[model samples]
Target chain A: MAAKNGSEAAEEHTSSAEIRSFFDSAPPLKNSLEITDKLKEFLDKNSLSAGDGRANRIVCVTSGGTTVPLEQRCVRYIDNFASGHRGAASTEYFLKAGYVVIFLYRRGTCQPYCRSLPADPFLECFEFIDESHIKVREPHSEAVKMAISDHQNVVEKGQLLKLPFTTIFEYLQMLQMVATSLRGLGPHAMFYLAAAVSDFYVPWKSMAEHKIQSGSGPLDMSLVQVPKMLAVLRKEWAPFAYCISFKLETDKNILLKKADMALSKYKMHVVVANELSTRNEEVVVVTGDEKVSVCRDKTQVGCDVEDPLIKLLVEKHAIHIVDSCS
Target chain B: MAAKNGSEAAEEHTSSAEIRSFFDSAPPLKNSLEITDKLKEFLDKNSLSAGDGRANRIVCVTSGGTTVPLEQRCVRYIDNFASGHRGAASTEYFLKAGYVVIFLYRRGTCQPYCRSLPADPFLECFEFIDESHIKVREPHSEAVKMAISDHQNVVEKGQLLKLPFTTIFEYLQMLQMVATSLRGLGPHAMFYLAAAVSDFYVPWKSMAEHKIQSGSGPLDMSLVQVPKMLAVLRKEWAPFAYCISFKLETDKNILLKKADMALSKYKMHVVVANELSTRNEEVVVVTGDEKVSVCRDKTQVGCDVEDPLIKLLVEKHAIHIVDSCS
Candidate 1:
């Protein structure tokens, strides 16, 4: 199903239908069925089906940066600036709030509960007693133990499901599958879209087949805008799902304006707007009726802004669930 | 110093002098001197200085991919394909061969002795006994324990010093410092150049001051060539260091030819050539005198090709050291 020709046609633009066709023509991931089955099992086991009389809410949290490959056999890519920290941290908070989370993350990005580990944790956190014996050093033992136990508890109880993706194709495909599968849950389903997705892409049909050679004097290529999937997502895939998207800007002047545009154009329930400089310290949550400013508590050392952000989101989701039922 | 203007004049090309001036015009990293001091102490403590009568070889292993930013405060970047797996695995083998290693790596890539860990090791490798108790899962315990112990042994003995970088500027600056420091050691120094560095970059002077706005309509960019630092390293920085570069290609036809070009152009002692499809299973060591194919033993499940690759490089380095001394 892969595109047969490389740069055979120079398409100038992409439409929603064209994007959908691209995905339909592209080869399905090898583990798609397995992941779908697992998601179904998790939701069923958690009693998240509509009218199941269970209060458990289910959320899919996407984290990290998505890559736009320039070639079919990708040797180079354009990447957004993200470490997956926000998504991972938010997942931990969601689980703590008694929500089952499907963590859809870029491979090799930070994992929930493991954020506080040292930069080189495996090397810096251990002490050698002898050549054959090793133990966690005293300075890091407490932190490592807590991280491990907390992560284990969530996984053992089946509260967290992780799915890893590397390229743009894999990310969008997996997201569609997950969102479509959650349509049955209606208002009980939520999506925290924190991943920094690329805005432009090289179409598979026009991409180079091999690694791009640098000997060429100059590279002159045109990239088409990635078809905005937000409209289809909100209107068709999971209409009743509570969707929260993010807007990150370097300029403070245009941040809220962009956020408002997203909320209106995409029909997102909430748009969290943040400037690059102060993102870790504060954010403004934008909805049609209200704009709520959330900030990290200054008194708490090493506190993350995601803690308060998740609390507000959970409350908002609960209200949506009740309103939909009524 | 930071560049004054962003893309005012479009420079069409880059040369070695331009590249050196770029670094000169760029702001110096805050901790460059601190890192140099630490490296000096590491070498002095290991008795690797000339006339110290020690046979300890020192190698600066560059790992992972360097990012080429489009903006001064980068929100997006062009990245080369690399996981740092080869570099990380090779570091362990170098350590096993009794070489002191300075691991200069990309911030979040794989690390030495940690390659065997699962992608989400903190989640997959632990089991919860109770809410407060956790242990390594039985299946992963032996491997985890050994990895931790072995990493700790080298670190405690000061045989491995790791420095992390994220951008092309930081990487090139750190590399220059490391190479210049090792200049005093002459023939005892070695460089394993495995990092997938970008061949094209937007010079800091020409990069956008803020995040590139999407509304600007089809972004037009001109990227200047990244100066070939290998040539500078051989002629000016550390001429006597035995250097081994890597050539990765998707086409088998150009793989050996590119390897040979790098060997002759940069005057490198050896160049490892591998096709992307079969890199894990096989690689050819290309030197001026001979080309030796090194393949992984298919029968061994856990064995990596880096073991034999590093062994061969180490032997070649030893021969180079002797020939230089005589």
Candidate 2:
């Protein structure tokens, strides 16, 4: 008998018609499923390799950016732009595919999607100031107040961590330290260098001693180039890590050219090229040998193209796919 | 015939000795006033200097801390604890001293402060947030609708500038870059390393390539120590910049010791040590050579210390104080 919820099941199905036709023409679907299950179990127990001694199925990902302090006394600080939305999403998709992920990131960005998170010690929920406004008071604001109170109260009881920095130099030093550590993870690591690094930085000799006047005159300071950090990934740190770079461009032609350049220069496996426009969603995933361009009908609200990108990644790497990198 | 007010003044003068003493002290008071005016002008022209040509009168400020991303794609991050209050205060105090301040910070932390900032671009008014968040409507709930809306509106119209960062690595990188830039400013630059830097960072080898299964297991990853950023400050970058390290200790006794350690280790001119027990006010300034502690009667009601610590810094460094540092 046909399944009662046949349409619902059909909607859940993801295989292409060609694959379905092959299954229908060859062996029964149930038999193929059983074989796959048996194969997975066997592989799990024996650790079978696909005709090679070298394990060729590893992906490394780097998330988050560096931080900077303004001075040695641990006061003011600076940093570049990045939020981790793309990095986190890609991490989730990669994890779902049963591939080992090497995640390198800054400390403050979002924790991995499903990791055990430290209870927000300072989750003091504030109440509404009015009906439209939430004031920091009783039952309504208890949660936020509780959180902040938890953070503060515990400190009052003498337990708190206060880490401070004053300038950008300290921040980069920290990142370099972390990167050097990440290098130890060895090859088969896929470094998704999605961190938005700064292009220009304050030159210390010119800026360190200068008194910034209140009513400013013509203020000028010379800028110097920070050593190209991504280059370090390719050369000194994480040599074996499969490096992937991002090319954010305003023009389409320039983007493709830049992606090609990145692939050639950095030996990147994939380059995610995004157009820098207002609420733009289309992206091109440039591989070493081919380019996969995705155009989303962003006209519909909440139609995130990130999902399709995930699907493409999975399909390209799935064992069933002929071009599965793994 | 003296003024009618003189009648009241004469009635208050009960003693002949008091009248004689007032006349005697008047000449000296007038001299002292002249001296103060001369000192103020001289101080205005020449900033307080460290013996070695550095700006002895300097304060380092920092704001923001580790922000945890809420989403997987590297967007929508969260912070453990940061409102940038302390940083803003430090900047204000430094400005009052008639010193030049080269601010290096991201945008999101400074958005609210920008609205209140008296306009100027050189070193004032900088807002730091993710570039993406610059336009998009944040997930709106009624609680902070007003704040979120105001922040977003200011951001979209370019009223504020954002220096974005997604990861700790990038943030650190930018920091290093900017620190070097400031290093060029010569010995007068004083460094305050006070931004809340994250101590633990994710190792690259631990991230999963695909999403982990829903069923819970002992999900664990190795977190490595980020290098001692301050040590790096003393080592490579800004060797000449006057360094003031911050020591935030929960214990009063430890505060001085930690500050002492920072001073010795970094060879800093001063250390701003504080007890985190009280937020409104509780901090000490520990110059490598001396310790100036501000002890407030926390138990006393209505006893407000209008920046006792800052007042001390001003007295010590302001050229007007005849024998302040002495």
Query: B1-326 in candidate 1: lDDT tens per residue?
Result: 10012343445334567767769756578898889889889988888776322357889999999998877888889897898999999999998888899999998788887887887666676665664445667787777877777776787889999999888888999999999989988888899999998876777776677777655233445565677788888888999898989999999999999999989988898999999999999999999989999999788889999999999988888888888988
lDDT of 2 by residue, B155-201 (tens): 34332222333344544554555456445444545565556565434
Backbone clashes (count) for model 1: 0
What does candidate 1's lDDT look like per residue over A228-303, in tens digits? Answer: 6777789888999999999999999999999998999889999999999999899999999999999999998989
Chain B TM-scores, listed for every candidate in order, come to 0.92, 0.54
The window of 10 residues in a row where model 2 chain A has the poorest summed lDDT is A1-10
DockQ of each: 0.29, 0.02
Q: Which of the numbered candidates is closest to the native, going by highest TM-score? A: 1
For model 1, the DockQ equals: 0.29
Scored against the true structure, residue B39 in model 2 reaches a CA lDDT of 32
Which residue ranges in model 1 land beyond 4 Å of their true spot? A1-15, A25-27, A51-54, A130-134, B1-15, B25-27, B51-54, B130-133, B299-301
TM-score of each: 0.91, 0.38
Q: Write the per-residue lDDT of candidate 2 for residues A1-326, one digit (tens) a residue.
A: 00011122223222345223322332122233443353344334333323222333334455555443222222223343355556655665555554444344554454333122222211122222443543332442333332233333332332221122222343344334434544543443345566555333334433332212111111122222344456555676556445667776545557788778767765666788886562136778898778887766566864456567756755554322233234
